[model samples]
Target chain A: MGEHETPADEPPTDEARAEAPVQHGCPVTDSRGQTVLHPTREQYVDVVKALADEGYGMCVDLVGVDYLLHPNRPVADGVTPERFEVVVNLLDIYNRRRIRLRVQVPEHDAVLPTLFDVHPGTEAMEREVFDMFGLSFDAHPDLTRILMPEDWDGHPLRKDYEVGAIPVQFKGAPS
Target chain B: MTVSDPLVRPGYVATGEGGQEMRPRSEVTSAELLREVGAVLRLSEADAAALADSDPDVVGEIDPDLDDQTMIINMGPQHPSTHGVLRLMLELQGETVLRCKPIIGYLHTGMEKTGETLTYMQGGTNVTRMDYASPLNNELVFSMATEKLLGIDGDIPERAQWMRMLLSEMNRMSSHLLFMATNGMDLGAVSMMIYGWREREEVLRFFQKVTGLRMNHNFVRPGGLAADLPPGWRDDVLRILEMLPPRLEEYDTLMTGQPIWRERLQGVGVITPAEALALGATGPILRSTGVEWDLRRGEPYLHYEDVEFDIVVGSYGDAFDRYAIRLAEIRESMRIVHQILDKMPSGDYRIQDKKITPPPRARIDESMEALIHHFKIFTEGFKVPEGEVYVAIESPRGEIGCYLASDGSAVPYRMHIRAPSFVNVQCLPHMMRGGLVADAVAVISSIDPVLGEVDR
Candidate 1:
């Protein structure tokens, strides 16, 4: 089993996984020594739940990345690139480890399952994502505009959103 | 009408979907109550159910008159005790706070949006404004993330790392000192505020001397620092170290021993360890729960591994514990600063890479190529390799992290600051849930949230 093992007699999984590592049914890639798992939109919550069960208890950060221009950005194999990516950094404090989950969301649908059921701390972070990226979270307790006014229009963090283009009315003279 | 049109339409209400206004108690459903209670307590399903059954009065479901008893009120967007523009919608029944929701974003200036427009060389200035209390920490995280993406994180000079540690520790002392002042002021010990500020000013004086600005110094940059330490910096640092110990002892006498101060904070705004962790609270708040997790010790970013210091923790996760933790943390930071003073290396302050670091000011005067390099670096900025990195360091408040995504451009494709205050502020409702309305100020002070960091 050790020295003269043929391809047929050998385990097919270990060598195959060495070429492309997968974790929690998602393609895992190492980005600068950090473990990054690329899970599809459908598998996002399940993978997060699985990781949480395995002791990635604290959800440290949740942010959205808009790839409107850089649509061809490199992702791990077997993962489809999408217009928007939600990055969640989970910390396993007991193990002193961190894992990042990058789930791709299409431009049209722009919705993902909420992490509130798992990590209640993400309530505000998810609201910020929804406020800044225009991506809605399904079943979020209060998915309101957090860092923007409740009445404000357009998500500001999207790549397509222009900067320094909002027109303002002068209070004193114009009226 | 096109959404991207620049013109403002007359009589258009914009159709924003959500609001922060608290609904009346009668309108709130049992499901919503369960969710709110579960969130505020961070309790598991069984515990939440158990609580509902045991204390129907607290859940407000059994008594129909409870709807009329509790009234929702706005605490602040401008209240003096709120720290900044943090508005809390509290449902109060007489003096007891029933449910609370923090309404933030009053200070949101779209700094992350601005980060995308700013080049890598100019990114420091944008991030430093977020956590104004510990601007150096914000700059340090941003610089570290940028350096990591540039594939030069390990090549940073020993002197630069020590210098960064020095400034970072000094900033922590000053920030905690400010917290001492504010925490005292919030809890009604007015004189302690003056003493706290006076000591903090001593630390800021050193910062101003080294960085040329007090707050929002952007001194720590990607390659290393904006400049080398000013002449006689060691003596200045020693002076801060010399001045702090006794002043801190005085604070211990002024506020720590006072019975009134103890009454205000002890057993008030209490949170369990699981709730604190589940809420993703870090730094003093998490430490106050006796979880000995400090990123400086756990992750060992920069040269923290070489330094010897103890992580200050508290047994009870109450306001008193949070206050005591911060006070003790000031001493721990000073200890770290002393270690840095002894271990501070002598060499170049920034990295010597020609591509990332601009030509020295002296070189730009003599050679045309040096002048062009300097101009190009300041104007176009250096391009970073395509990658994304999340760099978190223990800031004065909590874990201030920078998540930078590079598209191999001079400007970051998407720059996001995982601000600690933004996450820590979420604990306010959980902390204030069953406390008196007056204790809310003490709760807010214990958290020590800087709104710029939260709203950014």
Candidate 2:
């Protein structure tokens, strides 16, 4: 995104940037006003354990997004400490409730506590995250590349990682 | 010999005359798999041309099918029930499943990691890849989470909400239609393969009418939908509505009451009500076990609070119950689609605030502010002050959720999906225990797990 980030850019009006994080949950504000959700980052396991205590039993998915063009967080964070951030979604099947737990990690030793005791299903999901993003989970049972081969290098999902050998102009892709 | 489960056949897909009979699972061997994968993974045309071998899993049990003692059989990464590229290690004795372990992540693409880098509008397009079968739910869930963080639920225009509900229900029907078609094909009702695809294509055609794309309509966004329903979109939907009922009846006659359907489905894949809750089954799989809960009714969102619809549930959580619940849900979805069309409020399709939606095509060139807002959303993107929100919807399969985190950036800080297929697949081993090997296909069909959602 550095290529697209013109030097002339201006921060949003104070009206858009002034909302602070909530005290208890650290819920953040979006572009809208007075939203109850506070956006804050925590240790990945703390977010999971907190939600489990709150009674959501399911850890459904863990997805990765490269921040090459992100305009908010420091794009270079992945290259330094707090470089990699991962989102964990938990669910309360009985109550039909849900919550998002976000955690940021520095690149050199990108590691976080595991939530395997809380949701055993996270075992495979975390491994795939490790396999894809190269983020390490401190206590994950078998944190190996779950999808890509062991020899694959660089996190394909990162903003800085070029698609490389994969032809960007492959034919027959869906429009 | 009589074979129970339906197969496309191993190197024997001629479909007519005696191509060959598929061997039962007990006769399959690991050496054969090692042999075949060893070849295909490294096979050239010389290796390919000489390949007269059938699919290894179907050729025969590479290992003994049933020992008096239970042995775990890995059904996929290649088989169908796990859906997509799932590998289910099934522990069984004779035909009864002793335990099941679902091994996943064969289709992980890490779209969540990609979402953190794209703008808000791009997130909608990125998240849609998670659940390819019913994509509107992904868009809706992501939009709702963003709206929750932005504190703009009410600001979303009435017309957009109404249109979203309509599209959601239609997406539900189309998704279930695919499930039914596949379920029927799995159970040997070949004509259902044709009929199910026909109905699904009709719905997809309607989706193309509104979103210009069929599978992943990135139309629903935080502030509102991508755009208004095209002129005559209501009529296009009505065409399918008019004909869908009779087609559903054909499916009912072909599947619901047939003796074999009952035997294959009933008493199979039994999960107790308690187990359904404990195992985290939602949507039809949980509801069929007698849990009368749906987010639309229990935790109403969008226009559900204003609409009239029943939460479909079955008394016993079995394969039959799961299958019936889907049939029932198709009816419920139809009812909601009608109410949305009849009561839709007309107004701006998206919020008037310049922060969330892109400036309309007309305003992009004329108004400077609108142009700036448009450029911001596409480039830098709008920021959610800093907060997290979880939004879930009742997709055709079950609960499809979007968990989003924002640190005042155009891209999400973190985005996680709580896909239902991934959850319901957990109960596969429990349901298959004590069931016949033939019942495995029935149970898989009833669960209707989609690998896209699971592996994502």
Candidate 3:
């Protein structure tokens, strides 16, 4: 969405919307002077592996973001915005450079290939995204919850998940 | 949940659904071990294949003659040495740990979900509690992210930047002090605990005088600080700085040079640089592996570029190296603090922007407009430009980061903190492997994980 896109403003025309995003070989954008690459779910691991070979050895962080409310959020040309995004930050210590990869995962099919093969450090973080967002990884060994109980009903960090909808339960309280 | 259910097993969860289980070494085929163990250990295919070939004690298939000597044991959810409610399930063969898994979330309270409800102006209070030991760093990272989004990151006054750096370095010293106490206590140096707390308390006293709270001082805010430094804050800081060198020397005498301390930690819980990087361990754990990576030096944020300091590293990535690195870092932090004192600039502590900064108390009392502005700023809060940014800084633990997305509203669209301990805790299993069960406490203490940050 545009920075000044108020609810009162007229909806963007198809022609204007088409021309907004600049074309790139692989839809790249910048946020606050940092490089951001928008990769599809399929290209996620390959991009990370290639980056790893190029000295981005450490996978600093991997997080899941739900874009349910901001469905119309902006993206680079040739990139489609999905309901969910897996944001991975990779660091090249030798070169002192950092690159961010944003992989779009559709809500209907929210599975992405695990990055465990490339970066084993992402084990807990991948489990965390799975626990919080209900997004599964294709072959994540131990894809269970990391920060939630085994019997958790739904992903808590989802936009639609109500915060206090369920009654609080004590271990030995009267039902 | 009934007792008869197979899912319920005292403290152990059955393997298959991402749970870790240790099978007999004889039963684990080379291919199976390469696929399973190799992944967990981040071992290369060549290395895994080599490991499989080297173990020629028995056939690849399960040997009926070989007994399954390994038994799984739970270390903590309540063990005093865990630092907090961290639970570790260790698969032990005799006393050697074959496989280990860390089960966390005993302290989870969904603080990220809570961050969405609070406006950006009030978000500092929520993040400060994540790493309670280094609350200023938490607040500093969050504020930096928010300021980046607000596009006033460059406009921050020189004095404010210096002040933030001062508080951050001081927080590092205090957190390391706390670690010294816990590491000593965990290793049976009970007297070191008293000495550690004694020194840390003095640092906390300085924090209390400046921020009005010992731990979670939401004092560092988005625009600048919540308030300026209290009068005579320099004298208070100097007193603590002067008092620390001698105490640190006393610690060196008591623990660093002691044969018992060296024997307990020297070769215990060793991790190579490859493993540390692959496992995502940072801060002292990464540095202890002899990898020269420090955010302040490698990627300078705030006025770290202007300051002079050395990145301390270790030759052998052992528990002793970790302890020694942190001990040396305390002295380095003091050096930085002294430099900050010398170069502390004079200017407004916060930005003078009317949109973000609240009016002064005297102005609010005398003018109706000022009062109304204050009310609006506090109640409604200012809208941030629609964008997303991730800001990371070197906390005492590792890289504490804040990822914020705004939809041009007072309340953030999404807020996430990439906590260091959360990632660093993953190293436990790899580090504990092949070590004696007794050394487990040493490994845990060396990590010095603050559960509040780990589970947050």
Candidate 2 per-residue lDDT, tens place, B362-418, comes to 987889988877777788778776655667778887777776767776777767777
| C-alpha positional error of residue B32 in candidate 3 after TM-score superposition, expressed in Å | 6.6
Give lDDT tens digits, candidate 3, residues B1-456.
998764565434533233334444454555555555775565656665676666444334433433356677778889999999998888787989877888999899999999998998899999999999999999999999999999999999999999999999999999999999999999999999999999999999999999999989999999899889999999999999899999999999999999999999998888899988987888999999999999999889999999989999998999999999999999999999999999999999999999999999899989999999999998999999998999999999998899998988998889999999999998888788788999999999999999999999
Interface RMSD of each: 1.6, 11.0, 2.3
DockQ of 1: 0.60
Off by over 4 Å in 3: A1-25, A169-175, B1-33, B40-67
Considering only chain B, report the TM-score of each candidate against the true chain B: 0.93, 0.84, 0.92
Give the per-residue lDDT digits (tens) of candidate 1, residues A3-44. Answer: 122232222244554664766667878788777889888888
TM-score for each candidate, following the candidate numbering: 0.92, 0.72, 0.91
Best by DockQ: 1
RMSD of each: 6.2, 12.6, 6.5
DockQ category of candidate 1: medium
Relative to the true structure, candidate 2 has a C-alpha RMSD (angstroms) of: 12.6
For each candidate, the alpha-carbon lDDT, in order, equals 0.87, 0.69, 0.86
Model 1, runs deviating above 4 Å: A1-20, A168-175, B1-18, B42-62
Off by over 4 Å in 2: A1-175, B1-74, B80-82, B91-94, B364-380
